[model samples]
Target: MKKLLLGSVCGLGLAAGPALAADLGVPVRAAPVAVVVPGFSWTGFYVGANAGYGGGKFDYPFNAFQRQLQAEAPAIESRLDGRLGLTSGGFILGGQLGYLYQFDNRLVAGVEADFQWSGIEGRLSGTGTLTGTGTLPGTFSLDAGSQVRWFGTLRARLGYAWDRALLYATGGLAYGQVRSHADISAANGGTPIPGLTGGVATSHTRWGWTVGAGLEYALTQNWSFKTEYLYVDLGTSNVLSSAVDDPGNGFSAGASMKVTTRFHTVRAGINYRF
Candidate 1:
């Protein structure tokens, strides 16, 4: 009887153990996952393309020429006042390459070079008869024009960067090609003077300086967009004009004139940073 009771208790304990194990749910472990963090930086080299409009002043000082002609006939100087100066505007397209460095304090600095093609030009003319006293009784006509074919600049940039955007000022050396033309003619008693007509067309390269400001924003890790404004001054150029009689009987004269160029450009561009 004692052996049978011990056997029955052992069997009951075994059945209860299985039920307890089933009541307590087992926990399963899952695979590990990756966490990603993003960082922003502006230190890099970049290349870009740009397009915009440029407009500015064309200053042609013909006072010396007017004075010379006035000495021969004072009436000619009156017609010259309204024909010497003008404004020019046109399209500009170009590309640029540059490198930049950023500081922990959010200050940024860079150097850039760019070239552009331009189609800017202007023209003006005036004509009248010298009818007053102390002047030759003759009709005179004056014409002038100026055109800028292309330009480029090497510039230094300084800015403050906020996250992915920058505000900056830039200035540096500038160079370009300019073409200028001028003409003057006189007729006395309805007959053209033999050597009293002169014209000059000059094409040359000039160097100057430029200053401006811009805003740039980074669209992605490697791409950015920008808008900028620049003021450029290409120093003066001089052209000579001469008129002489064919038979040595007409008067011989020469005029010296100077041209100063200045323009403002606004452009938008996209850049690839590396």
Candidate 2:
């Protein structure tokens, strides 16, 4: 009986061994799955294409009569205003490249460069007759026009960003090339006024400054869309000067033109961030 009881007890303990081991085996658990999420940032480099409209003022001032020929000068000057107002406008298309950085406080800053093909142009003309100048009364006519062919900008941007959207103010160097044409005729009164007929067409590069503001929204991690407005001023320039001699009137005089080009542009663009 003692041997049998001892064997029986050993068998029971052996049978329960696996159950105890299962309950107390080193508790193993998958390391609490570590999860990490990312925040939105506007730090990146980008390239973009844009299309827009441009409009502005093209003013040409010529006062050849103001220069010489005293007798007929005042009479001719009085007959017509020596200004050609070529109100200007047209289409603008371009591409740009830029870099941007976002600060901890959501302040954003960047620099951008762009080149565009522009079709801004204007046309104007005026005609009148000169009388009582002591010479044969003369007929005067004037025509003028301007076209901005291409333009570029190197600008610095400052803005505040809200998650995926940015609001910015920009300003900097603006440059462009223009072609202008002007014609003047104070002819056909042999004794009245010295017959003078001349026209000038010229092309030159202009430099100026631009200031504006914009809003940009990110459409994805690597893409954005923006709308902006800029005011650009290329200052005033002289495009032509003229001189004529008339032994008939015993007077000689010259003509000149002064032009002022200033414009505003509104643009919409899509950008790819790198």
Candidate 3:
């Protein structure tokens, strides 16, 4: 009787152990996982568009014309002594393409090229009478104007970037198309002098240099916005206007004018990186 009782108890213990193991379920080893982190980088190619205001100075010096007139027609020297310096401002729209690289030390460098369409213009005029003894008694009128049609720049950029923002200084070559016009006419006794009317219209593409600074903010990993200011000088262009005497008359004179263009531009832009 004692052996049978012990055998039954062992059997019961074995059966309970298997049931408990089944209820607890089998052990599983989890697979390894990879963790990823995102970081910002300023190494890429970008294209962008900009819109803003541009204003500047158009300096017209009549010194050469005045000197020539002084020797040829002394009566008009006083009128020709006046110079024209006009300030012009207008809307500007443009696009840019560039590439940038960021160094480990937080230095960012890049090169960019941009083109802009502009509508900056200004006009100036004056009227006077030439009444000296040797002069043709008439009222002289002078009208002059200048316009900046378009402009462009190729620049190198250097900056310090802090995470998602960059502050930079830029300088490079600048070029632009400029148009200028001058009209000078004379009226004697309320009648216009046919042979004395002179006009000059000149269009030129001028080259010079530009310098600027800007701040750019990265809105996302692939997009950025920037605000910038640039000062540009497109150098000078020469224009000539001449008045001829009638066929038999020997008196003929020409005026040489120098038009210098310089401007300031403030702009906002959006860029996409690739």
How would you encode candidate 2's per-residue C-alpha lDDT over 42-152 as one tens digit per residue? 899999999999999998876655223456455333233466667899999999999999999999999999998999999888777754444545677778888889999
For every model shown, the clashing-pair count is 1, 2, 0
The weakest ten consecutive residues by lDDT in model 3 span 63-72
Where does the lowest 10-residue lDDT sum fall in candidate 2?
72-81
Q: How many backbone collisions does model 1 have?
A: 1
Ranking by lDDT: 2, 3, 1
The TM-score that candidate 2 achieves is 0.81
CA displacement after TM-score superposition, residue 42 of candidate 1 (Å):
1.8
lDDT of each: 0.80, 0.83, 0.83
What would the TM-score be for candidate 3 when compared with the true structure?
0.76
Taking the tens digit of each residue's C-alpha lDDT, what string does model 3 give over 18-98?
Answer: 778778995656899998875688989999999999998999886312211334555342224446888889989999999
The C-alpha RMSD of each candidate to the native structure, in angstroms, is 6.8, 5.0, 6.0
The residue-by-residue lDDT of candidate 1 on 94-182, one tens digit each, is 99999999989989999999999998888878876644344545777778888889999999999999989999999999999999988
> TM-score for all predictions?
0.76, 0.81, 0.76
